[model samples]
Each structure stands twice: as C-alpha cells, then as structure tokens.
Target: MTRELARRDGLFGPIRVLERKHDGARLYCINGSLQTLMLADGVSAFGYVHAAKILVAEAPNVLIIGGAGGSLATMLATRGHSVTVIDIDPAAEQIARDFFNLPPQVRWVTADPLHFITAQEGVFDAVIVDACDSSGIVSPFDKPGVIADLLMKACPRGSLVVNIVAEDGAPPWGGWLAAKLASLGLSVCLFRSEEGWEGNEILHVRVDGPTDRLAITDLEQRPPEARTYLMSLRPHVASHVPVPATSDNGAS
Candidate 1:
C-alpha cells in the first residue's frame, strides 16, 4: 500500500511526497515524473538519477543543481562529502526538509544554479546536474552553455555527473550534449540503467590525461541498481545512439 505524505504547489506543479509499503521508500514526485527517494539518512535509491552518485568518489565538496527531495545531497553528505544543493523553489526545499529529512549540514541555497555559481567562493570536486521540473529538463540546464559553466566551475581534478532520460527510439540528447561535454576537455562515459525497458543514463565525466581519481571499475562497491548500470558500460558509451529508423520501402 502507498500513501501520499504531503503535496506542495511547486513552481512546476504539484510536488508530492509519498510513502510506499513495498520498498518503504519516501517517493518525491514532481510534474508527473518520479524525481527521487529518501530511503535512509544519506542513503537513497529508487530513483535512477538519485542513485547516480555511485559513480562519483573522493568528492568532498559536491554540488547538486536540483533539490526536489535532497536525495543526492543526503547520500553525498552521508558519505562524508560536504554537499550544497541549489534550487529556485522555496517550497521544494521545505518539503525536502520536512518530509525527506534533508541533512542539517547541507547548504540549501534558494537560487538559480546559473547565478548561484557566479557568487561561489570555491569550486566543487563534483557537480551533479540533475536539474529538472515537472515538464522535463529545466532552464539553464536545458541550455548547453549552462552545463559548460558547471564544468568551468569545477576543480581541475574534478568530475561532473549528469542525469539524462533515455528512451527506446529517441536520442538522449541528439549526441550533441555529449559532444558539447567533450569539448570541455573531459572524457565522458555513461551508465545505462536499463531494466527491461529503456532507463535513464548517468554521464560520468572526468578530465582527461592524469588524475588521482579511481576508474569506473570502482563502481563495483555501489548498490545493485548502480552496479547494474556500471556493468552495462562494457567498453564505453560515446554518445546517445538512437535506434535506427524504419522505412516504408517494400522489400522483395
């Protein structure tokens, strides 16, 4: 059985917090999209993007661009990472703190991500662009330049993680997003979190050449969902390869 814990009239639409008896996860939903989950303090799964932090390591200072349920920030903080989450909606922050139990240490900044970074003091070791809304990808994050800004704000020896929804016949980002990311002098690898149907993808990007960070192989220590995603990245995923189109031409 499932019950709605609470709902807020967010900027996007109705932001809901739900409790499911099956998995006992606190569901965070917005704009009809399953946004995140708060399973335990600083531990979360359920949502693909919320679990993508498995790919990031050694990032003591983490930046999350969205604050739907503070799942990402919670997980990172639980791992001893100092995380700062940014969101323009105050109601989202309230729900996160009230129902999701947002960690007390996490710096919740109620501001646009694009402008928030401009006033930052130091760079983050990792930046997660889980920016979204009820409709889909939100502004600034929807614009490619804003992504580049996140990278530029990252430490040289840093990584950038992004959540992208994948569909059967659709190009995740027309492959241009990957290209755009690579132009920032980083190598991009994606973990396809597919489970029967096409699932969302997490882009784990790191600066090329040399670094002290561990390889993607380190993902073995992550949760089952994240492990499955990591293992799916066999050789490497260069871009969002769309399913080929079919033609009406008759075949003999």
Candidate 2:
C-alpha cells in the first residue's frame, strides 16, 4: 500500500513516496533537494551525515552540511548536542520540519556551507554529511575540498568528524581524505557504522597530535566493537589503508 506524499507549494524538486519494511511506514524523497527515509520505528532518517558523532562520548557543537529529513539533526539535539544544520534548499528544510518533526532546538541555517564559513572562524566537535539520492547513491556536491576546509577551520585541532560512504572498489578515499586531514594536523580514523549496507562511514580527525601519525595499521587494532561496527556497513572493507594526508597547498 503506497500513498502520495504531500507536496509543498513553490517547492522546487521531484517528489516520490518510499516505503520501508516492518511497520510499513512511508517516506518522501524530494529528489535533488532532500529525502525522507522512514525508519522502521515510525521515525524518519534524514539520510544526512551524523554517524561521526558516535565517537563523541558527549555531543558538542554539531554542524550538518545538508538537511534532508533532519533525522541526524534531531538525534543530535535529542542527545543534548548543540546542533546547527544548513541547507541550500529552503523547500527541503520546510518539508523536513513539516513532515519529520524537526525540532526547534536544532537551528536551521539556509546558506552555502562554504560561504557561511569563509567569512567567519568557528569550531565544532562534530560534523555530519548524510545527503544523497533515493537510490542510496551519493549526490555530487561542490568540491570535496570545501568540506575538508570547513572541517579544518570549524573544528578545533584534532576534533573534526567526516561521515562518508563506503562501497566495493570505491577508490579508497579513506587514505586520501585522512591524509589530507593529517597534513592539516588532524589524526584520522575511519570507522564503519552499525547501520550496514547504507554506505555509511565515519572519519574522525584529531586536530592536534604528538606528530606520531596514526598509521592505518593501528586502526586495525581498534577494539572489536569498532571493527564489528565498521564491517557491518562495509562487508568488503579489507585491512585498512593509509589515506592521503592533506597537501600544504590547502586545496582541500
């Protein structure tokens, strides 16, 4: 049983209904703007980046680069984390508020992430990036460097978290991205999320280090819980590889 999801007036995007298993809740995918994936438990998953927050024992200032259904934002807020979410599409933010019950505690900012951060200097403990298509494919945004730069500027030395997607033969950005962070003085660790098959990844970069780099070999020695969590999402993830450190050029 499928139903037509509500469409907002003047909202610029394609709309479709997506049904999930178990309770059979329905979600609305707003195409390029955002997607509302219904969690089996009557809640909705905003399909944005929030997995990196898992590493933090306590939530800090959390920034979300994309606003889908506001799932991750809400989760962070619920856990008492000061969260701010940004999205270029106003319609997507509106829809998330209307349908997914995005909370008032989660500040919603409508602006380009790069532009917003360029004019100011701030820092955060965590940053999530979970925006994608309904088919579970990652959508191409602007330069990946923009995000890398934002991570460098907004996060205190050694405290940036980037959520990425893991795929089979996916050209191992784990090393490349981590290396970029390392060059910027952030020690990096890549972990697979417990949410399996969602292409979910959590890359944690510490801003200040002892200059003793965290080799990919050390990542394999993580506790069983972390390894089990990562493998759950990326069954094909082999032994870790050294991600590329950032170059001094600051290209991102």
Top candidate by TM-score: 1
Q: 213, model 2: CA deviation in Å?
A: 16
Give the CA lDDT, 0 to 100, for residue 68 in model 2: 66
Per-residue accuracy of model 2 over 51-136 as CA lDDT, tens digit each: 34454434478777777667667766777888888887766677767766778888888877667767656677666665443322
Per residue, candidate 1 scores C-alpha lDDT tens digits across 1-252 of 779989889877888789988776788887767787666434565445434565565677888888888887877787789888888887888888888888899999998777878888788888888874332344555444656567767655687777766555444552445555665556766555445232565666666642222345555455454555544443244654432232221111
Report the C-alpha displacement of residue 48, candidate 2, in angstroms. 9.1
Q: Model 1 residue 122 lDDT?
A: 80
Tell me how many clashing residue pairs each candidate has: 1, 18
Each model's lDDT comes to 0.65, 0.54
> What lDDT is reached at residue 152 by model 1?
69
TM for candidate 1 is: 0.79
Give the Å shift of residue 120 in candidate 1. 1.3
